[model samples]
Structure formats: structure tokens, C-alpha cells
Target: METRSLGEHERSTSQSPRVIALANRAGAPAGHVVLSAERISKSFAGVRALQSVDFDLRHGEVHALMGENGAGKSTLMKILAGVHASYEGTIEVDGTQAAFTGVRDAEEAGVAIIHQELNLVPELSVADNIFLGREPLIAGVLLDRRRMVRAAERLLERLGVAIDPESRVAGLRVGEQQLVEIAKALSLRARILIMDEPTSALSASECETLFKIVRQLAIDGVAIIYTSHRIEEVLDLADRVTVLRDGKRVVTAPIGELSHGAIISAMVGRELAASDRGAAVQDGAVVLSVRNLTLDTLGPHGWRRTLHGVSLELKRGEILGIGGLLGSGRTEILESIFGVQRGWRGGSIVVNGETADIRSPVDAYRLGLALVSEDRKERGLHLYESIGDNIALPSIGALSQFGLRAFARERALARGMVRQLAVRCTGIGQQAASLSGGNQQKVVIGKWLATEPRILLLDEPTRGIDVGAKQEIYKLIFDLAAQGLGIIVVTSEMPELLLLSDRILVMCEGRQTGLLRRENATEETVMRFAAPGMAAWPHGTAS
Candidate 1:
């Protein structure tokens, strides 16, 4: 939280003369310009991904590039990282015009980028992956394994990361993998580091550690280009901010000049309406019920219980929330109800007052149940397929005739779902990978809607999306609940849980610790229940 002035690192002897010259142009005694791009424009098959966008980075400063999904932030970063060589732009490094033809070219020019989707080989050792292509060699042929491991150890130590260099990447956790990625970037001696959504999948504790490393890098005269959808992180870490919208630069200013609302307005091009969850829906009949669900799993410590006699109920047209810390079995409850938990036992599920037999996801879907898992990329949509194909995948039989898929009817259904969900895409034929994060999530939801589900199980539905897209999703959820759909949402964000749920179920160590109505839920109350081994509340406190 300490504030360091840009001038604090100006006296470093490592700065190049060109950087000093660029610093003089700023008309202030601060860090010099390390990299700049002017009039960056790119097009893909007649679609303009970026147009006349301008950006610059200064030595020892953390500059944030932010925008809604499909707003050209990634496109611009790709150009800077040399991933797209056909872009129309002029890049200047150290006050000299530079043209990078490939990723290697950018790295050689002292610029490196860590993509949002990590690019590490899971089967390779940490040291081998870090120095894969540029590995040290003896006699111009033999691999220098010792040298590579030693170098990797030094880099990891510099970043305050503790990981065995000989360990395979497949066994590491997400946060450790991220740190390895950073260590790899630093091995290139990069003067400008571009990190895209670095903390998207990281836990709260890991984020703090990463923040410390980022700040330290800046103090060491590294120019950092940071991009994230989390606005609070931008406010906390960025020295300056550049916002892009619709493939054009909207504004560039000091972080002190922007407020939370201003940044949201600029990214979305309008004010986002606050969610109104107070207009309570009159509770209808019990739509789904679960009794005494339990699960056993083998972990590092040995056999352990994941879920301990968990029970919950959902009413028609109601949004029920599940809240808990990570590993508190919030996701397990949904997986148990959806029949995806293979080890679940001693549970009875009743749908509309009849004993239901849901042994698999297909059975759950046939019972008018749908689950939108948290990891969309891995579990939800097929990225390689078209939007229409993904949407029609769940209900192919319904759209088929004589065992042949009805193409015309399938396209019509996909189009209808896209329209209903307000999905932004060029057409139904576009691949799911081409769409942004928000649209990808929408497609996942649309695929389930094709099955005509009555009860929706959404887990972290808004996890890596922008504020504007989150607002749209909230509206969509409310609309669905109004149409008599029972919604069960499991979220880690406290505000989202409070804003969306009429009643919340708090879990602690896989047990139903507390249930609070909307009128009584607060951050403190929810945390108290979510804490492990908390004392029992008074009888009748839970609604």
C-alpha cells in the first residue's frame, strides 16, 4: 500500500539514454518512457479489432489497460507482444522505431508478455519449460541441465516463489504455475512486462503475493503493463490507466483522476444500472429438495469427508445462494445435486415431490435440471465448434428428424437463444473461441437453455467478465427467476451473493452451518457462519 514516486528510480544507472530523452518529453522529473505504440490498427476478415489506438509505458510504472470484452484490449496487447505481425502500427522502444516480426523479436527487444491463457507444457519440468527454446548448451549440442536448474532457481528466488525446478508443471497448482510463468518472463531480462489477467484464477492470498512481486519489479525499474477485469486491483496497483472501447482509445490519465464509476462508464460507454434484488418473488411450491448428502474423497492427508450431511431446498421462482470459502464444499453441493459427484451417498433428491434418480448429468438434464460449471473453458462449451453447434449440442435429438440433424431448425434455435441472451457476435457461424469471455459464458447458458431446463445451477457465473457484462448477466438471471425457474448460485464474491439471493445457505467444512434470509444477511454474519468450527447459533435463527 506504500506509494512510490516515479522519480524514486530515475537515478538508476541501468536506464538507457533514449529512455531519459523520452522522460524529458513528459515535462516532469519522473521515469522515462520505455515503450510506446502509435496509431495501432488491426483487422480480421473485414472486422476492425483495433483502430487508431495509442498507448505508452514508462519506466518503473504500472500502467493498466482496461476495457470490456471485445473492446480491443487483447488485440492491442497482441500487437505489442508481437503475436500479430500484420498490425498497422508504429512501435517505439527506447525512442527508436522497432518492428517485431515474432515473439522472439519482441523478447529480444526487451519486451515480454504473459498471456491470460498460460502457455506452459504440462509434461515438462519447471526448469525445462522455463528455458525450453533457449536452453543452455555445451559444445553447441549437449543440454546443460545443471546450468538450467541453477538459473531457474535464481529466478524463482528473485520472485519469492518456492517450487522445485525439477518438478513437472502438471503437478503444480494454478498460483504456482502463474509464478513460474512470471519467473520465465523475468529470465528474458525483460524491461517491459505485459501481464494479462494474471490474477484471474488466483486465490486472495496468492493475489497478495503476486502484487508484492509486481510492486518490487517496478521498484527495480521494470515497466509493467497490467490488465485485469477487476477494477479494484487497477485502483490499487496501477500508476496510470489507459482505457479502450470499441477498438479505440477512450482516455489515458493518472489513476488519481479516475473513480470507480468513471472507469465503468468509460469501459461500457454508459452508466450500468445497479441490481435490484429487493423486489422479492412470491415463493411457489418446492421445486427441488435434497436431504443428507455426503461425499468421501482421498486427499493428500488420507480418506476424508467432503460433504457432511448437507441439505437444502429450492422454491420455484427463487434465487437461492450458496456461500463458503474455497474448499468449503460449496461446489460439491451443486455437483452432488446434479449427479456429477461419483462418490456421493446417503442423499435423497426430490423433484416436484417425487423421488428423483439422478445418477449422471444426462439424468439430471432429463429431469429439467441444468448446471453451468465454474470452469467454462474446460467443462462448458466446445471452443473449436461454432456457436450454433455448441448451442444445439445439448438438445440434438429435439432438433433432429429421422436420426438426422435438422440444420435449418438447429440454426433457428441457436439464433433465437443468442437473441434471447443478448449475445454479441458476428453470426451463428462464428466459432466459440472467437467470442469474448462474456459471450462465451452466454453461449454456455444458451446451450443449457436449449434443453428447456426448469432448475438452473450456476457456479461463479460472472467470474472473469467485465462490469458491463456482469450487469447483463444479473438481469438475465432475474428474468429467468421471474419466469418460474429455480436458481441455485454458488459464488465467492460477497456482494454478488447478497445482491442475487433471496436466501443464502452458508457452508463450513461441508456442513450447513447457517441459513439467512435476505433481511438478515450481512458480510460479518456470512463470514461468521462460513468460518470453521464456529459456535452454533440460537435455535430458530435460520429461516
Candidate 2:
């Protein structure tokens, strides 16, 4: 698969002349080497992060760097971008030896990196953040706010995104914040670009826009180092891929030379079996039902209705998937049902056939409902806190005896959850930040599971985790469903939703457009109803 098969995007833009130009740096031919790292070895507190890793990028190439979490992918990328200055290695830029002392040095050398974790200041406007330290000056004195905002708008337009330049980043959603981050990177106009899991927070529609941008950049001869867990997209976009496993480069070849199995095998050092979607369990009684779920928010333009009479049902032991592009009210539906979404205008929630007036998370929790938020670092976990402390947060009251805390009970419960989830850690006392992406996600899920909820709501259940951990979590969901826990999963990945869902509920603009049986759920069918104006799904049903 290649960008040609991604379909033609009509967007076309001319770069700003006043903004930093992104010409062919080093005056090299299209296929000439632009950047290289030889025998790069790094360590952290005595642990070897990378073992003599070697990688190279060309003038007009989309090189994909791949590996599981903590497999030395980030370490090598950080070394290249000058984030890790203490690494032992030789870096060459444009056939000349170069040592970057810091990120500014790398940027000055025509290199810019977009980290997987967002690095924007929430207090600043989108335009301010885009040109943070390099804000243009009027006559080299006054801040050129007009030029900065215009340039930012052009960058957003080039990416086909509709974010306002004046809007503060704090008010934006995770996906929107990610778009801002990309815009910030593009504003640099660097010849060498590195993107780490750029699409982890983007929606299907936004991803299309980004793919178009990437394709255009490649045609313009900008070298890009793209990293992603979504192998399918990599197969479509990258010209070559370099697989790193446990800190060493296993293979570097043209994308066409390797199959999906080959990539997975190289990453984990084993052939992984495809996930089997076993037969759906026998029907269980309805556990949750929502009717006329309406929500409104006080935006700049007064009150805007985000949810429009969305309705759904979850039965015991069944996994119901909510599928949609970003801002389609997928997360809002979950939050509203969990009594977290703001300004609930009208809605009726029925749990176990009883009408419930749930207004807060505590009320929902009391009724045996738990929500695992999409962002683990910010909302789900205390990164600096110990694993045992995090898992025992919600259940502290229940684990206590009178006014005194039951330390032994907390440790016992944490140990049980850790063993059940297979979280690899030194001990329960280890800080959550010390764990890998997969282990951190497990802790988030485990903490919510400790609440012992009958209904579970998971948003982006496997976002930013590796393939191995994804498989384990998939199996765990099935196992939990089999034990009669009703689950609702909100995911942007089509294949994941299809695999884990017993029935798929498609949403568009906050409206429930289609309800598909597991057998009827395909990528094409789901998109038919999920995308607005894909011709109305006449046969679509809510029942």
C-alpha cells in the first residue's frame, strides 16, 4: 500500500514566504542521505537503553521507526533530536559530523520532532504556542501578533484542520490538542521531521488530513521519520521501515519487502497469533439503558448542543462498541451515562430496569458503573504515586476500618489486581511513571476494576500501547465479558472495534445513525453510517 492508494485529497497550499522556508537542505539529490546515526549506544542509570543502534534517512523518504514500548525506539529518536545529550554515538547531518547540544541546536540544524506526549502550554493561544520562542517582531521590536496568527491559520489550513488561531489550547479536546501540536511542528519548516505516534490522538477524518500533508511533504523532498503503532497506516505511507527490538535494529528494509507477520515477529521476537473472536455468549438481561440523552455546553457562541437524543443499551456479558470519528459525541455519550458530562439537558438513565437520577461520578459509582478515561497520565493515574497508592485511590474508603486505614487490605488488593493484570513492575511500591505504556494502562483499568462495577465504560481502551499488550487487553475484555460484566468500548480504530464488539453502535454528529450486529460490522459498513453525508444509511436501525 502507498499514498497513491490513500485517495487524492483536493487540498493545495502555498508556503508563506516570510515564514521559515523548507527548501532542499544541504542541496542534495532526492535519494541522497540527509541524516545518519552510527553505533548509537545510550543508557539510563546503568540500564542500557540502546545497544549500538544504526539508522539513516534520505532526502525524500518517509522512514518508519518501529518497536514495542521501551524497545529503544524513543531512546534512539530522542538521541537524534538532541533530547538525550549524554548518549555515546556519532551523528551526521548532510554527510558532515554534527553534535547537537540541545533541542535548539537540532532545530538550527534543520531537525524538528513531534513527541508522542503533547508538549504545548495550555495557557497560550494556538498561534502563540505555534511560534512560542520564535515569535515574529514588528521592525524587530514589537510582537507581530497579526503575522503570527495569519501564519498559524495558513498552517492549519494546509493540514485541512479548522482550529481557530485565537482559541486557548486548554479548552481543546485531546484530539484537537494533537492537531495543534502538528501545526506547531509544521510551523518550524524543518527539512528533517520526526513524528512519534502522531495519530494516536487523532480521529479517522483528521488522520486522512494528516496523511495528505505527509504525502505532500514527501513529494516536496522533506525527510520524515514517522513512528506509529498502527502498522496498517505505516504500510500505506512509509517508504522504508526500521524495526528495533530490545535496543538493537533487527531489520531495515523497503516497506514492500516485509509482511505484517514479519514486522510483529521482529518487534516481539515471536510470531503472535491473530486474536480469535470466539462465539458470542448467550443473551443476558439488560444491565443499562439510556433514552433521549441530550447534553449542551456553554461555548463562545452561547449554549451549543453536543448530544442530540442519543440512546443505547448494554446487556450483561456483552460488549457494545460506540464507533465514530473524533468530536462525534462518542466520549460525551459515555460521560453523560456515567454522570460526568456537563449540562445534561434531558435524559433518562435506567439501570437494571430502575429509573436513576445520576448526577455525579459518585452517584454512578454507587450504582456499580466505572469509567476508565482515555488519558491515563492526566486523569487516570498519579504518575509520581506508587502503584499500590493509585490502585487503592477509589477503594480507599471501602478498604479502611472505621477512621483508620487498613494497610494490609490495600496491599492484598493491589497484589491481586497486579497478578490478575500481569503488570510487570519491581513491586506495588514502584512509581507509576516507572512502568511502560502497557503496564500504565493496566494500572488504570485495574484501579477502575477494583470498584467492582457491573457496567464498565472504556474510552480508547488501548490507545498508545504496543501490539502485545493490545492482545492481552483484548483477551481480558473477553474474559471479563464472559463473567457477566457489561462493557461499552469507545475506540477510533475500526479493526479493534470490530473485534471486541458484540454489536456496533455508529454515531455521527452525536446522533445514533446505525446499530450493526457483530457479523454485519465491517469497515466499509461502519464508515457508511459513521461519516456524515456518506449517503444516508436507509437500512440502519437503532434496535
TM-score of 2: 0.87
Q: In terms of TM-score, how similar is model 1 to the real structure? A: 0.93
lDDT tens string, model 1, 268-319? 9999888985666756699999988888877778878898888788999999
Over 296-333, each residue of candidate 2 has an lDDT whose tens digit, in order, gives: 98877889899888878899999999998878889999
Q: Which candidate is the best by lDDT?
A: 1
Error of 1 at 290 (Å): 1.2
Give TM-scores for every candidate, taking all chains together and pairing residue i with residue i.
Answer: 0.93, 0.87
What C-alpha lDDT values do all the predictions have?
0.88, 0.85
Residue 477 miss distance in model 1 (angstroms): 0.1
Estimate the lDDT of model 2: 0.85
Best-performing candidate as measured by TM-score = 1
